[model samples]
Target: MRNICAIIVVFFMACSIPGYAQPRHSFALGDSVFLLDNRPFQMICGEMHYARIPREAWRQRMKMAKAMGLNTIGTYVFWNIQEPEKGKFDFSGNNDIAAFVRTAQEESLWVVLRPSPYVCAEWEFGGYPYWLQNENGLVVRSKEQKYLNEYKQYLMALGKQLAPLQVNHGGNILMIQVENEYGSYGDNREYLEINRKIFQKAGFDGLLFTADQANDVARGFLPGSLPALNGIDNPQRIRQLVRRYNNGKGPYYVAEWYPAWFDWWGSPHHVVPPEKYTAQLDSMLSAGISVNMYMFHGGTTRGFMNGANYNDKSPYEPQISSYDYDAPLDEAGNATPKFMAFRSVIQKHLPPGQTLPDVPAAKPAISIDDIQFRETTGIFNILSSPKINQRLLTFEDLHQAYGFVLYRTKLNGGAKGKLAVMGLRDYALVFINGRRAGILDRRLGDSSINVEMPQGSVTLDILVENLGRINFGPYLLNNKKGITQKVLFNNQELENWQMFSLPLDDINAIKRSAAAKKYTEAPVLRRGNFNLVKTGDSYLDMSRWGKGVVWVNGYNLGRYWNVGPQQTIYVPGEWLKPGNNEIVVLELIKPQQAILRGIEKPSLSN
Candidate 1:
């Protein structure tokens, strides 16, 4: 046994040397533990989404994970961003899962791929393609043939890029997870079985596993495959549960050991002190229970990629743009004190003479004060071609996926009462004759507002914003944006609508005029410019601004709301240039000042 251990360490060390040919090793499930190259292997992993991190920072993030004493990297494949449009696939840039895995290999790390068709990682539509909702009678994450067929097609397409990288194919991927946390959604064993088969068909010929909370072991586990626990720490109970499913043998694994939790828009930023989890981690390590930290480093969710949560208990809680997850690493990829605590605990459990790598040096950060907005534009000024209809059409109905939509109609005179929007999916700004009337937010359960119509015909426009799609619980399938149904004036149904799909795919295309000296609640785009001597990571403080999205050099920096919790947007230095850089903000509400500032550190609070 000692000889085998020495050989494994030497082999890995050799693989780390430059110009060395990376050798593939076997990863198999033992009676009670994982076997790598016929030796017991304890998998220490960290979850980090490649899409959430900038492509330029992938290597640096991986190095940070390695320095934190992680041997494995876990990631989920988001279907929405991978295939934004039906049949149109993008595997390059940040969507490059293959490159991400290969980079993990370059760092001498193995990977656990969770290629989820429905990953409830607080991602938009739970990582599902928006086009799926357009299919009639297609129930997602189910046995519906339409959904299944689409699922299979997408998996196969993704397989072409990633399946060949599995461990069995001499790649670094050690295990591939089945559908993510299915027990929380359903108890259909057949649905899981179908998913397992689809993974195999997609060319993942490596060890397979299913992860669910402790109580969901029976409901979520795939028979004849490795069963892993999520959010569980009790060693005795973990062993008992795994043995019962493994025919009285062992290999206890906690797939998601959360050190900290994620935050939503209106809530306080979540933080778990290092003291709270260091002991649990030590206990698990001493018991040889392989563990994967849920998020070793939670990066930012750029663009309209951030998702929302909905259920009977909670109102619509949209996730903040900064995924920051409050994990061991901060949002900008800087190691936190929690990282040090975890590293110390992990180092204590390492084999004799084996040392964790030195922590990477902190990246430089820059701050700019008062970036001036010299130009402006409004939603009304930048209208697109509209689709005319008697009734309203949804974002999907017009083949749109994200951003804002404008619904315009002429209101006949002498009509005055409560303006009710039936099935307003998220939020809308009501306008009467080019003036702000009121606002309706689904988060507040607001469906209508009292309005008095003018004596003559007046233009009525409702600009609806897709806050984010429901990313978890039973509401995953109920994801359609921008007014899913009818709008009413008093109890009378309103008609003759012209719908403008504002996907906001390209912010740079929008023409801008001179900046407004004053402000209004109407949706307006403000442009600012700042010069830099050298580019480094920084946070754009949007605390003074109202609810809206910002773009740096045309790269959508994500959304910001004055709502408590997240106050600054993480601006990756790679997005900035040494000379002049442009910043654009689409403010939905008025602000006290038109000025913005860049801070060196993230202020994820109100």
Candidate 2:
């Protein structure tokens, strides 16, 4: 065994050279620990998603992680952010993960890539591109041939960009994870095995691993790899769970230790005391077990990127725009009490003579002058040609994701009867003859909404908003938004509906819609301008507004509902230009007396 280790070290030594891809780096799975270059290695890692932060700010965040006494960086590669369209891949700007890894390497930090094609990080559709639904009979997170084919295609394309970055090839990547938390989802050894094969085939070879909660550990791990656990407390229990699957050896690992939790719209802000998880973090280190902070820094979920949730027991619950997670580092990357507490714990656990860097300077944030919308636009006026279908279709069927869809039909006989739509994907406003009759909110879990038919050939319009797609659990596979089935009035199915795809991918349609002469209702796009002699980080207070999306200088900040949990949309200083800037809000409900202001802090629970 010693000779084998020596030979492996010699081989890697021969390969480690400046700028050489896959230079001789040796990282292997020992009885229960990770062996790097024949030595027991400990990983104090921090998890953050590159897609959630701005491209320009990646380095700053990494530096922040380092200052917090972290040796490694962990991140999930979001599939939807890269492959917004089918067969088309993006690897530039904020989606440039290879660049993100290389930048981490510059900071002398190793990386653990959670390349789960199904990463359920409170993201839309668990990071699966919405276009995947367009494939007929395609089942995700399974061994289905078509699904695997697409998965392989995406992995191969991703590999072409990231394969060379493995530590063995001279990069800093320590391990690449398979599908995330599979045990909690199901028992599919075959599926995980396929995942392992494809990852190795794609050149992500260093060490492959699986991570799961305690309840699902039995099936989350595969043979020939390290098994890791995720939880908030009970460090000893975390070690025990990993050992249960790894032959009771040393070098126990916890992949995700939650210091805070995520929040959904309309719910109270989720928070935790600094000692709640930090104490457990200290315990894990003291016990000689390595752990990764699930979210050292939780950033924003800008645009229509936020996901939704629904099940047999619960209504459709959409995540708030901010991915803040109430973590050690706030949404704006400011270190909170949790950050200071963790740093103190880590300081005591550091190897002799190893010192953590000082915390970085905080950016200044301020309130800007209030802005108002002088011009108005109607959604109906500026839309692409409608797709004529006998029945209503899903967003994927219409090649749309993360926006609104309008389904319009005419009541020929001016019928006066009870109207009910079955299985509304999310929220919708029922309209009769251009006036809102009632609203259908999936959050209430009530698929049926009453609608009164008026006299004289009334036109019926149902505008549905795709709050977000579910990111986890049994409902993950079928999270297509918009109307799933048909509408019914008096037990009679309605037909001949013209559906308009309001994807809101770009504001061009909204800009053109400004020509609309008569705009006097909700779902109206209000425009305003604000001037700033100087610019810094700030949050746009949406307290006076109803539920809808917001845009600044044509950039979608994200969805802001009047719900108490999240009342502000984070606007970074870099996104602002000195002088004048534009602000647009799509108030879907009662367009309040538009009183918008910029504040220094987020009123999450207010």
Candidate 3:
């Protein structure tokens, strides 16, 4: 009887159901479908970035993804946030990606990890750490040896945190991407292969793939690896491109299906109507193709980390801090009309025996109508000790990433002629002896201006704003922000300059500056308070204020410009309290007593 009972237990263990069984095999590429335990698998993936959302709110976001009928979640590991300085890395706090992936696993969702060292997600420097600009003669996203060595180190560090989490090791990561969308910038096959070898060397045993736009696949495709397409939901076109470039063997995947678009400063706010995407989604699901929404949810681009972009003949357009991206889930994590429409589409595509969880309850949002400001300060209120240089230096040269840099020098013969600032990163507010002279805006492609000098020696000051660093294309190699080169008066270069570093990546120092001076510079700060019996999410109306940045209870909410599209900065309820909450605004100019109000919905693309 004992022997018979033991035999029964063994039989049950061996005949465990597939649902209860361990993943028989790690995810692998099939000839035309992703194979799981040698059976075909359809990946319904949604993309979200851990850096964009609050650390405390990560698990809730994961639950939302699962509730949306997605079995897979995709995210790009930001190199700048992970390894801000060379050889220095931070995986704690909101930068803790390992914690994020584990949370996804707990939520029963698989992960597609895209660790783009050069992720052009409208992020600063295209996700490259600004310090990379300091590397002597280094060309990023290239086959350059110096760059590859550094890139190799970064990949290894990431692997240590993520490799064990892959499906091969009993974790949930399905595959990891090589570099992000390289073909759009160049046809560097050697560089693409190098990235593959680096990922392999880092112990990534699951799978590796490259993502590129459909037309650029031929240029970006790596031999012997899977190819992923990013763009509109044209399943047929992507299928053909992958079959042609991937040797006719494909599980055709749409890597970045666009449901919404990104925003830029001074550009109209972007919104992609839900109807524009529903039909395409239906067709892809009907065809059984795997799809990953580029921005299933876009949170926010807090801090000075938002990137800027420019063309050969155009001005610099910095990305706004509110990444919102007009995704299904808005910046504040509230579901929109599009979210409801998208839910039905996802529910229709689930496989047999699968069902989506009900949508989570929406977070409450409150409106504060009578907010008031009581204190103010100027940007140049407190100055850092200056570094002397024969000519102006770039931000990277000073080991700084983002913020304002002040360049001051004296002219013995009084400056004259066209005052040209060689390689101005973006914008500059020129002032002479503490008075506004003129403006040099990169958006208008203006770097030099006519200056009429009066008799005696005069002081020349150029407060250059490192609007953002370019994160994509050929220009990415030389994206050293601030004054990249020397400043010139007429045809001659200026000398004996004093440069100050004002990287406002941290607002603590700025808060102290606000205490010293009420108003001193072009950009200024205004302080106020509002009360609430309860706290939730809200949008601070920027319709009345000029262009600048905002902070709530010491948390920087990002930038605000009167320029339409995104006029209100999102304020998370997590940062609020029941009784009193303080609000601070960095008003660049035009300071006055203004009444501020908080609203429930966003006013992007103002």
Candidate 4:
């Protein structure tokens, strides 16, 4: 009897295990039909990058997604921000992947994780660490051994955090994408396979897929696997790509349906009407195709992490700190009319007994004002400057990635005619006797220009601005900050330049000092102060000033440019004071005066 009981127990356990252990749904290929767990399951997702949104607002955003009738949340994990330094990983605070995944789970939402160490979301360096470029002969996003090895390390690290959250692991992560939109770059089958292997090795044995625009699917989509379409607006294109890539499988998905766009320096503020996006959403839903909004919440860029885009010929165009992608959720986390329209459309198509949740209330906005400032250091108080190849270094060297670097050299020949730089990365304003003489822009690629210089023991100041780095394409891989070569006058490279490494990672370092000095070397700190009575979010207009970095109460607002597109700087409300706020301005050029004003809106071209 005991033996009979044991056999019955064994049989019961086997029967229970199959129900729990079966794969969430096999993404199988078939003619005219696609299956999810052998059943048709449509994905309604919303895309929102975690690093861009505030941690405190994650739940609210997820709730917002649910209210929009989204069953899934698609996110890109930025490798550069996650692991700023190689071997040192960070998943805490805003970088927490597990927190984000679990929050979606609590909201009964599935997840699509796009771990593209190369997410070109208008991010700084396209989400790549500048240090990676510091290495000799390091080619990114390819089958290169060195690049793959580093890539593997990051993949394994991310896998450790997310592998357990997959559907098979009792969580809701439904699909994982290979590299993003690779067809735009090349047709390397070997590279795509290697990426698949890495994901499998990292324990991500769940459903794997690839996303690309509709036209690029032929070259971009991997054969015999799930192919998701990105940025597809028309139903015909979506059907064509889905059938073409998935062997006529009918379940199609729009991986990145853009409802809004991003802004750069000198461009007007941007806004997309809700009516257009509503029409697109209605079309996709009515056709029974899954869709994910590119940016459900377009949040702030926060720090110096904003990137640029250049296609080799053009100058580097860096992105603005305000990532507010004209998304349904604005930079301040407020839901716009687009959010309501999307929610209504999705509600109209829901199966029986289902209703979308109510929209969440908007967060309170802080107000700031009444500011005053004072200066403590002048240009002459530097000791020495850093030189490259025995020549005074340009902003490209001394390893200054962003912001301004000051270079001072005593003129032995005295300033006279035709001052020129051998190479100016983007833009530079030259100064003689603490006065502006000329400016050079790389847009023209004309570094050699005439400039007026004064006589005997004169100080030559060249303030260089990081116009921005290319955030997309092959040129993105060639982004180099500061001056590439040396600055020259009439073909003679300037020497003995006093260099200042003004990356400005710290705000407390700025202090009150009343001293007149000169340096023959590198790393100089300039101090200044500004006052404020009330407090609110504002933009500091940095266009009048030459290239350099500005700090309000020690918060790094991001690089500024005299160049068009992004003239004004973003100053967050949290960085302001109720009364007098200290403003320290570091100018790499020779300027006699500094002036600033506050603007309520972002300055970007529409």
- Give the number of the best model, judged by TM-score: 1
Better of 3 and 4 by TM-score: 3
- Give the whole-model CA lDDT for all candidates, comma-separated: 0.87, 0.83, 0.82, 0.71
Worst 10 residues of 4 by lDDT: 515-524
Instruction: Check candidate 2 and list the clashing pairs.
Output: 21-169, 22-168, 22-169, 22-170, 23-169, 23-170, 373-527, 565-604
Q: What residue runs in model 2 are displaced by over 4 Å at the alpha carbon? A: 1-24, 513-520
**Ranking under TM-score, best-scoring first?**
1, 2, 3, 4
Ranked candidates, highest lDDT first: 1, 2, 3, 4
Superposed Cα deviation of residue 203, candidate 4 (Å): 2.5
TM-score of each: 0.95, 0.94, 0.91, 0.82
Off by more than 4 A, model 1: 1-22, 513-520
> Per-residue lDDT of 1-606 in model 2, one digit per residue for the tens?
999999999878756543344456788767655788888788889999898888777888888888888899899998887888988889988889999998888788899998879988888898999988888889998999989998998899889878788888878888889879999888989999999999988878778889888788898888767888877357667667777777776568788988888899888999899976766788878877778888888898888888876678877789998988888888988888888899899899888898999998887898987786687776666667899988888888888877899998987655566777787888898877766777888887666655666667877888998888898889887777788988988889999989988888777455544634333454677788999888888998888878888888877889888866898899987788888998888888865457689999887877
Clashes of 4: 57
Candidate 3 per-residue lDDT over residues 1-606, each given as its tens digit: 999999999879865532233453558888878986678888889888999898778888787877777889999999999999999999998899988988887788889999968889888888889888777878888888888888999989998998888887777888888878878888978888888888888888778899998878888889887899998477677678888988887888889999998888778888889988888888887777899998988999987888877777666788888888878887877677777788788888777887888889988898987787777666667567898988678888889888788888998655468889888887787876666667787877788988877668777888888777887677887788788777888888888989989876666666444533322345666778888999888998888887677888888788777765688888888888998888877775455545789998878865
Judged by lDDT against the true structure, how good is candidate 3?
A: 0.82
TM-score of 2: 0.94
Give the per-residue Cα lDDT of candidate 3 at 29: 80
